[model samples]
Target chain A: MTMRSNRIGLLTALLLASTGMPAYAGEQAVIIDNFAFQPAQLTVDAGTTVVWTNRDDIPHTVASGDSTLRSPPLDTGDVFRFAFTQKGTYRYFCTLHPHMQGTVIVR
Target chain B: MLDVSEGRRDALKCMLWGGAGVLWTVAGGVPKSRVLAPAMADETGDGNFSFVQISDSHIGFAKSPNMDTPGTLRAAMDQVRRVRDSARLLIHTGDVSHLSHDAQFDTAAQIIGEAGLETHYVPGEHDVLVDDGKNFFARFASGAPHGGWYSFDHRGVHFIALNNVQNLKAGGLGNLGAEQLEWLERDLRGRSASTPIVVLAHVPLWTVSQEWGWGTADASLALTYLRRFGSVTVLNGHIHQVMQKVEGSVAFHTARSTAFPQPAPGAAASPGPIKDVPAGKLRSLLGVTAVRRVQASTRLAIIDTPLGG
Candidate 1:
């Protein structure tokens, strides 16, 4: 599901439970689709692993703007996982479709 | 022209029945392309010398539709050998490997070497998956610009090899960037517009299907540099299919893959190895062959034949 869809699901779940839900910890995912990343920007804790899954049918790659990180061509269903160990905002885009940008703010 | 249309119609009919590839002959600045069965291979090329174009050899690709990509690539090389004597040069449009691993490049080199023909290469997006094509340039000719785009002259034809795959822009479109565009302007400066200019790159310089990111974003700027040319042929191989388009003096062609075939533009949910073509017919759509004729003309005659008969 897309990030919006997941958010809606979470909201529904929280409403149904009537209890304050705990925040997600340590792991996050970015979905690649329609030449854009779902949840174009993300925030996570330091030492969290961000997994980018290609939901689109075409191939895409995750690459850092400063040329520090890159992933091989990720065909449909392929997943690229990276661990952000430091507290900084990591910006990246699909090398194949540069317009598709995303960010992960590690706090 | 009517006869050629009929020929294409017949070729399309043949394609439905599993016959693939076209034979082209150019003379007096006019190009004639025809589709011939492998049985009619003898009719394919009649030229002083012809060159081979093979594209999208995704060596590390291990997916459905095709599992043994190297085997299929080897078969493609065999087809190249079949016409090696008549074809003097082999130009691989791009995507020499699925990933730009050293071993993948080595395997591609070994298989392509079997053809025993001099080969020229450009980078495909897959081939540049690592270090922005550093490993790819290291294996091939080094003199190209930092991004591996260059041009050369051969047999009275000025072949301009471009690197559109690098530095992709928004919308997943390929980019030639300013540096390459400047070089292209200077490269074409003062050259006779009448010269037959062949531009080679990985993605289609012309917009084929924008939704799939098959086109180059800055291709129009680069093409503007060649507007004065009498005949311009742009060849590319990212979409993994044989598609042709003609715009005034420029002719654009994209080649099929030796690894696997992707859906036609907007034909599938998204583009990847088409998971399920009829088992045997898959080979019919994926292969390479060449056709040419010698003449002092500025037009390009392209012939694409599948690796299998």
Candidate 2:
């Protein structure tokens, strides 16, 4: 009876460990190049991570319309990541080239 | 001596003379020159007129595309002279020089003077580089506001020259501060709503993308004052490209640079001199627009012409 009780306790602990796993633990990479953002429009779940990688030699930045959520100017091979906790559409562009535009949709 | 005819004969003669005098009076009422003048003037009158709009001359720039900046400016001047009529006036929107250098100003003045028309200038970012725009103020202070915004009447049209480069915020949009706004309100108070209003500034009034610093910080305020005018034309230069927007009664136009062409808003990796084009194509890349105003009417017809053409 004691052996059977210990077996049951160990089984329950293993189930909880797998079921309570955290979401979005890894970073999602976005590549910027040729004056455009790859996957110009991105859709991600809430609490997901988004990363921007500058593939071009020139400098670029990601600035929102309201001047909120500004990423530091990224040089070649530099990366910037932001984790989305809320659901909304965020539009951004490279400050160096006001025309280089992209949109990230957080679901 | 008054001639009196014999009773009946004198009376008849007087009546005939009176009738002939009335006929002569009627004929003489219309001048002989009036009959011939319209026909004579019609043959020689082409009735075509044009003016010059030069922006972003950037004379002191030492970049590769336009190392000898004055040379390109001279080219623009040549284009102006070749197209300009005798009645043309030169209107420089802003950025007359790149570095606000004394020699640059001097050279620019000499080159522009060659056009032989009275030149009007508004200050640009580069022009106000020294001491909150002291250098530009010293030279162009007359008839301008504290920051170099001014208005004048020419050929029955009202031209308001604004200084947007001074005290400009991060984005390139122009600002008409409180004092200037008050002055503008008063200056435009007495004018009729039908008056053709032309507002010239260095930066674009409309939002031309804020990320790249291509738009004005406080343009909506100034635009509110201009909305009452019927034919409002806003001309600007800073982004170094020809982009036009017509909103309600106002038409906003941005002229290209006489120096070098920056890349299209989002076409390049970043905004800078686009060196990919051939050297000879540079002149073709930049051009001017000729604005013609109709007499006794507020209508304006604009024709965009390339430099070589």
Candidate 3:
């Protein structure tokens, strides 16, 4: 099953690349470390699911502006996944520490 | 570093943090600090009334430096019980639960309720996250003015409970939303400037560290209203450490956590718990702050008492 999914993800990436779109894997991971989002800014293709894994000792959340995403309190080692099916820019922040923010440009 | 008595060790630890044994007194709009031992400091001061401030219990947290959060809170409660005869009431600054879980709130209520004293609470960002404070307000705050913010009078002192954690804006610090600010303006209206005002919230009203998100965003306007008071004591938590600031007659203080200790401002990369606390040294890092004022005393003394020493 893993091999099958990998092939399908690669095929989808190829199709998006042929259309002159940002080629991104179907799944992307963002690390929450040091009370900040590692990338802080990300560019992902449509239909890509973004996963945020909390690596810091404290808890955080990935909450979006237009309600595109909302994660429960994520403790250390916990993960919150959201699929960005629409093509738009998404802004999110950790409600617990709102100073920590990020932007996702979905193409 | 060497074999020393627990009391002396605590004194050393307190010296490093600049917290314990320092009695704060505000006279004629000027603040003064004098060192005193915690044991001697607890004596029924010449003040007419005294209350307790407990904060950042962070129940349901099981991690380094402190494995059992509830256990530390219980121990801290024991210290409070010891002074039940002298301490008139209890004020918890916030963070009653780590994840705002139902069982976590239940455990906190069960333990704090044992004090058998009326406890007033404000919502921490953590407590309001799970259900927008549905669980927190239901259990700890009912009929609270302006949604988990209210004001009460005790011993001729006016206590204002402000909730700066709710509706926090993105890329901003803790916020007392616009509606709540409007309510606060109305609440303070008609009160004389001589009223001793005590403001309680989870986040420090003063900017302790902007990078760490340890302050409230709209606190400047709130302070504008409070600065006129003769004696204004602003007690806050969520930093998990003791910090103080005095501007004129208004004194701002942040209490230590009962669960675990976080690094001082800018001391660590993040404001997370200090995991490497030396073995047998955790209790000294955790403490409860007492707010007391003697008869005819013009200042409110906030003393931090460690659970162990």
Candidate 4:
């Protein structure tokens, strides 16, 4: 009986670890590295806050092609966060290095 | 080494050639550029004092064409040491580091400090990427304004360093904002019109290439204030190449990078480092610029010398 309860507790801890702490609601992270966005495509629900963290040594920017969304130059370890309000596809590229591209889909 | 010939109405034609050295002479408010052998640039100007301008070090960058950025910077510094006696003051335009990391800034600072010369700096877009230039301002622009713009006077020449990288727009044109512009107008109000004004910024004050975001927005207003001066020399370093233009009394020149060279405007699909540069040609593409005060004259002559030469 005690062993079963301990196992259940372990399972609960694993589930919590996988789903993350409850304090943060609908937060997603995207990494900018190697002159390109890691996981170039991201999907999240509406009202979710998406944070872009630059890991590359060089500077980059997150700018939408249509001039809707734009970010200042991001150095290494710099973060730019935006909360999606409506559902749509957001495509972006680094204005400094335009070859680096990424996409975000809000559903 | 200048061959000055009369053009239309007192206009001088500047003939510059790759691998062929050129000397620029400005006298009596007229500009003349002469193309000679490559080594002639080192000893062309007749000036009592000279200063060097190095830009775009990009210290922490780890990429192709030039992964060892610090090594390249050290080489550039070696070139500085060679011209140490002539070029006393050093001015770095921007991009001290590839990333705004503390370590990157620290490394670049140590390397630049080895030059042992009085150095002036203005923050680049890369330097302000993290924390909005808090790290850069604290290190280089201490006691400066909130946005890190400042001015100083040296050897009868007034130097104004402006920060235009703040509050960048979607089009990538740098913004100087209203506050700085007002400050600049007031700063120049009391100065004499005969004073040789040297204005330094990270991005070109003039429009080099709007599509590449090489120009500063609202720079015309700044130029308006400088137009009164007899010799208004504008120096900048974001494009990582040598480009010059003269608009009336204002002469705009951009310096090359000490790290890597970027493709010319519209030369490539994107404006980044030239990755496919030939193995031995990298150092030749990167170098330093020197400005000298003409002897017994008020004109300031500019000499751009590459590292490889």
The top-ranked prediction according to lDDT is 3
What are the DockQ scores of the candidates, in order? Answer: 0.31, 0.06, 0.70, 0.11
Better of 2 and 4 by TM-score: 4
Clashing pairs in 2: B173-B215, B173-B216
Q: How does the DockQ of candidate 3 come out? A: 0.70
Instruction: Please give each candidate's TM-score.
Output: 0.75, 0.58, 0.82, 0.69
Tell me how candidate 4 scores on lDDT.
0.70
Off by over 4 Å in 1: A1-24, A31-48, A53-59, A64-91, A99-107, B1-26, B29-46, B279-309
Fnat per model, in the order given? 0.41, 0.10, 0.75, 0.08
The per-candidate count of clashes, in order, stands at 4, 2, 6, 0
A best-first ranking of the candidates according to their TM-score comes to: 3, 1, 4, 2
What does the lDDT read for residue B293 in candidate 4?
30
Q: Across residues B1-309, which tens digit of lDDT does each residue of candidate 3 receive?
A: 754575455434433322222233433433233322234335545454656778888888876655567666776666666556656778889999998999999999999899887888988888987878888998888868437888999877788999999777788898998788888899998999888788899999988889988889999999888877777888888887766666667777777777777777767887877766663564444333344332223353434333221
Residues B1-309, model 2: lDDT tens digits: 533334334222221111110000001111000111101222212343334577787777654454555665665565555444533567777877766678878888888788787777888767765556677777755666565778888655688987766543322345667788788888888798877777888878776656556767767878888888766777777777666566667766666676666666666655665544453454343223222222222233333223221
Docking class of 4: incorrect
In order, candidate lDDTs are 0.71, 0.61, 0.75, 0.70
| B71 Cα displacement, candidate 1 (Å) | 1.3
Which regions in candidate 4 have their CA more than 4 angstroms from the true location? A1-58, A63-107, B1-47, B279-309
Off by over 4 Å in 2: A1-107, B1-49, B170-172, B279-309
Which residue pairs in candidate 1 collide?
A: A97-B172, A99-B170, B21-B304, B287-B307
Q: Tell how far residue B124 is off in model 1, in angstroms.
A: 0.3
RMSD of each: 9.3, 22.8, 6.4, 11.6
lDDT of 3 at B227: 73
Instruction: Report lDDT (Cα) of residue B232, candidate 1.
Output: 79
